[model samples]
Target: MRDYFIRRLLLIIPTLLGATIAVFFITRIVPGGPLEARMRQAMAMASERSMKDAGGSLSEEQKEQLAAYYGFDKPFFPAYLIWLGAAPQEVEKQFIKFEEGQNEAKVTLKTLLPRAQWTATNAFKVSEATVDRKGALTGPDVVGWKTKAEPEKQRVTVFRTKFNGLLQGNLGVSTRYNDRVWAMIKERMPVSIFYGLITFILTYAVCIPLGVIKAIKHRTVLDNATSVVIFIGYAVPGFVLGSLLVVYLAARMGWFPTGGFVSDNFSQLSVSGKVWDLTHHAILPLICYMVGGFAFMTMLVKNNLMDNLAADYVRTAIAKGATFRGAVLGHALRNSLIPLATTLGQIVTVFVGGSILIERIFDIDGFGMLSFQAVTDRDYPLVMGVLVVSAFLTLLGNILSDFFVALADPRIRFR
Candidate 1:
């Protein structure tokens, strides 16, 4: 386990390095800027005018300045290396620092200036109360007070982040939303995470057993009917299913929310009532993700189980007086699941890392929503940041998938 962990950790370096390179390259292919972002929006006329105006005479200097401000100044490989190696990994540290012996350097005003006396250690205290003596940052008071400091103690943190640099729960700034990416992700994540997870659970619970049952029953009415149903689920696309569910279950039947994360008046409701409202809103999306989601997994499990059932060990178990149920659920289920269960580790990130269309359809504000907007708006840096995140997720998923292989079949070892 120790060796495996070390190997995985080592792998993350190149994984992130590659992600940085890919993200940087991909961003350059996209053009436009902050004004262009607003103007290109089909929904906003003023922004479109601004974008068109900017596009006509965006000077080389202006383009370069924009690129530099957003960290697109360097050649792709250099930028990737710099971002991976030197970018500061925290939000509160989003400040510029002067180099040692470089006398005239300064932190720019546009940067997230520390509110008076914020420190790496004392950042959390910033929201409420005065700074302790030991932690006070000495800046000129009242808009120009100048206090000299020890050159050695004068480092300011920067805000650029990468995968290997990701702190636990570090959702970076939302380049599109004009809010902390973490906050945005938090608000929408609960909706999708809760909905997707519940849906996943319901899906596997229902489908796995049903698949097993159908396989055992073998072309009886139960088996035939279940197969037909599973085929239908497999046939229908997720978005179509989601839309239909919204119309029928939520809009027509009025059993669940039609769209959106919660009712507008949820906050005004009592705590229990708010919870009830959230649950009601969640039901439709959850059902949507689940109803169409299960067939692939179910088919994978049923086939794997049936294949195992014909294995020598399975026949041997039957020969030893094991009942069909015991052979199916106890021995075969455990063995087959290692292969199938690996998928969970991969899918676990989908709620957090992807789901752009689902977020759009539901109008839920999240990383997915930001990513989608970034593409349409041509906000390159923001789009690259999201791409980097997606790459990390894919890497992490691959790592767990490998680990699952090891756990499922002990003969396989992690190097």
Candidate 2:
């Protein structure tokens, strides 16, 4: 069992590496470079105030600087090499001579930062040189200006912020937000994590029992009535459902908050007040999101249970001496899990990224909301990060599904 678990866990590294590579390539090559994201976001905020407002418009020169900082100025292979934790970056710069009296003074520095070597955020190496004010250059690639300042006087220190560490790994900073990529991940992920947990529990709680009972009492009036409800849930699109709920329930009953995270100043509220407000806001989105997964799970579990009813072991167990309850719960249900296992496998992929439409309609502040913003904002890093996370979850879901199936079925063994 330990060996099996270890092998399964080890598989994740290569899987994630492949996903990372694919994400890196897809994000870079896709139309509308990094600046497009920033531009779009700025426009979104400003456009609220104007008929149409362009925010933080970038010049061609500024665009070049942004690209250089991200090492997008480098060849694609070099960019990939840096991302993959390989290759020494070749640097660039020039030399300038200042005629101070008869004795001439020369300094080696960046073309951009005249007094210093501009530390490119994700750069491999930046060659230092001298260029005149008009933009002409002279001399060696490495900084070796003759100076009188002592031991390291000859050495020019480029602005070297910590780039490689546990925190700052291969992936560069976000093109949209000014902060580090990892930092953004930490800040934004909690909302999604909370969202995932809450919705998942709600979905499963409503689905499994409903499915089991419907299966146990197949063809009854109760089953028929339940089926109609489930059908309606599955038939209606999440957005349409959310809007209807919002208009009828929220607008009419005045029971739910329409938008944003928590109350405006939830911190100031009393403990119960905070809880009440939080639950009030969350209920509508939760109910609407649950409809899709819950209804589907009900149908899936019912179908699987029906199939398991005919499994050889189930009938054989009953014939031997087992009661209906024992035969169904102890034997058939165990086999039934194999089908539910597939549904569970799909959960991570489907649920994690699934509620986008619902969240947007309900105005829920979660990853789904961020995704909606990313599309409109055209924010590639946020979009790619969210997508890569989704892909990772999907792969994880498949792996877990296989492991669960093997664990549930003792006859199956990995040699």
Candidate 3:
């Protein structure tokens, strides 16, 4: 088992590397980029300034400089490498010299060499050139230059990659929120975990016992009635149930807060008061979150238990002087729980993913809402950060599920 677990853990490295490579290239190929978004914002601001006063737009040179500043001028693959912190940082310096003669000005562009070897190429069109007071060309001519560089062993920084910051527990800054991605996620994670814990606890606590009872009762009225109720809960979506609960329980009866995870002055309240306030605000959302899971879990437990009860082992146990109740409990119960045990890992992952529509409806600022906003705003850093975390959890969860399945069933062994 130890060797099996170690092998499974080791497999995660290649899986994560492949996932990151796919995500990085796919995100880069998307139409709009941060640089373009920044340019649009700049243009809008420029337009607003023009309306207020005699304003001007950014020049071509200014645009090029902005692109370079943001590292947009580099090829996507190279930029990706730099972002990953696997490539060396390069800085270029250029100087243009002009000499005035009788009719036209002589133009020469020179690029300073860096530690890395580079080839420089320049293109200029001298449509009409006039010499300035400093003997520099001042005309409508265009000049463009590009340099290609190969880093030396001493020049390249081997430790830099886009994930370097992530490795150090930093999620980088949000381009949209203007704050640290880690800070934003940290602020919202509690809301998700709180409701997730409550939902998980309530669902299992209620459903497991109910499922066992339903299985024991089999085709009786009690089983049918419970099935009907579970189906109703399953049929209703969490968002729909949330809205209904808000209308009937919150608006009509005024038994709970309509939405939100806590009161504005919750910190000022006594400990018990704070707890009451939290539970009051959470009731509707918690109910909504749990209802969907309850029906499915109950049905799963019922079916698994019922099948195990009818198995040959239970019949043999009953024939060997075991009471019906003892046969079900001692011979069938443990095996019945194996299926549910496999799902434990997935439940853990759901805590982090949260429910987007549910959070939005309740006005809860959680990971789900943050992810939604990040995607819509194209905040790549935050989006990637969330994705990486989610992917890691999902992969880890599957591995954990395997361990759980092995634990639950002694017959199933890991080599």
Best by TM-score: 3
Give residue 195's lDDT in candidate 2 (0 to 100): 64
Per-prediction TM-score: 0.71, 0.72, 0.77
The TM-score-based order of candidates, best leading, equals 3, 2, 1
Model 3 spans > 4 angstroms off: 48-56, 64-71, 88-164
Candidates 2 and 3, the one with greater lDDT? 3
Native-vs-model 2 lDDT? 0.63
lDDT of each: 0.61, 0.63, 0.72
Leading candidate by lDDT: 3
Local accuracy of candidate 1 as per-residue lDDT tens digits, 1-415: 7588678868887877676666667766655655445334432544534443543345444454445555555676665545454543222222233555554433322233457866665533222212111223333321321222334445333232333323333433444656655455455556556665666678778877876776677779987887788779778766677777777877799887667778998779999998898887776566556666677777777788788888999889999999988998889877777777577666656556436666666666656776778778665545555665667777787778877777778888765
Residue range 239-302, candidate 2, lDDT tens digits: 8888988888888888777755588899999999998888888787777767766677888878
The C-alpha stretches of model 2 lying farther than 4 A from their native spots are 1-23, 36-63, 88-170, 311-321, 343-354
Model 2 error, position 153 (Å): 27
Which prediction has more favorable lDDT, 1 or 2?
Answer: 2
- Model 1 quality (TM-score): 0.71
Specify the poorest-scoring 10-residue window by lDDT in model 2.
148-157
